[model samples]
Target: MELQLALDLVNISEAKEVVAEVAEFIDIVEIGTPVVINEGLHAVKAIKEAFPHLRVLADLKIMDAGGYEVMKASEAGADIITVLGVSDDSTIKGAVAEALKQGKQVMVDMINVKDIEGRAREIDAFGVDYICVHSGYDHQAEGKNSFEELAAIKRVVKNAKTAVAGGIKLETLPEVIQANPDLVIVGGGITGQSDKKAAAAQMQQWVKQA
Candidate 1:
């Protein structure tokens, strides 16, 4: 399993500061949807330029023109780009094909999809790198999570690795680890902490031990 640090609320400089503290503990640095919205793909370019070793994931949550978006993010030095699971199969295929040509990856975010398992099976057929079960900030506000959805995707997604994200914290990392997701994503769980380094260190340790 790998641990990904999501930089949603931070700007490029703040994102760098946080990564500098916990870079050793994380395998991937995520330029979250919010960060991308705020700083554009320049955020991805900046982070990747700063930490060349750490993989950078651009959370585009793309719904259309997948090929073009993936190409743009890849050009920005994004190792992986995201597409919405609710998007059409043609979009998913375009993204995957573009990613393959660019030697990058596509992670399909199943944030609002209703039938996760079914959709995961279909997406897996397209050879996506990862199928992520995610609960956006709005759903998290209503007290929703994607733990069960993670399990559902794990059951039928044979071609793609599985990932889980949404409000994951040090206190809840153990449960997520037990689910055995291929990748574990956390945003406020670590970024919102008083001691970001310590929080990231502990979560990294736990993910490694698992």
Candidate 2:
């Protein structure tokens, strides 16, 4: 289980707290789209600058002018920049190209993508690091861990690495890993708790046992 700690509220202090707590445990620290859209690229820079050791994933969720967004996030020290899966093929192509030139990583986020299989196949040729299966905040409030969609996403992408997020918890984590996601994300499950570090540590143990 490659843990991704999500920073959604966009507070640098909150982000720093989570990082300080999970720095030794989590693999990737994500600057969520909500946070980025609210706070701009500094959210990514602040998190990256604060925790330089951990890998930073900027959830820019770019939908247009892909190259500019990717380049901007990359310059902000984001190791990985994400673009919306619903974006036009040309936009995705442009983002991927910029990422390559910037020596950065690209992740295509499948948030509300109409045709998961068709979209996945469309961008399979792009040099992407992860095919992120995401659930926005509104959908998460409704109920979570749509294992069915996750399974379908995994089935479609045979080559690109997989990632899944959306209100995940300890018990549901096993079912998520069963889908063979390269990364399993948990935001409130950890950060929402009183002890973020202990929350991370507990998850660390769970993944090791898993």
Q: Tell me, by lDDT, which candidate is best.
A: 1
Residue 118, candidate 2: alpha-carbon lDDT: 80
Clashes, model 2: 0
lDDT of 2: 0.83
Specify the poorest-scoring 10-residue window by lDDT in model 2: 144-153
Model 1 lDDT tens row, 85-127: 9999999999999999999999999989998888999999999
The TM-scores of all predictions, comma-separated, are 0.99, 0.93
| Candidate 2 per-residue lDDT over residues 82-198, each given as its tens digit | 898898888888998999899988899888887887888777777677888787788888775456667877787877788888888766777776677778788888888788788
lDDT of each: 0.95, 0.83
Residue pairs in clash, model 2: none
TM-score, predicted candidate 1 vs. hidden true structure: 0.99
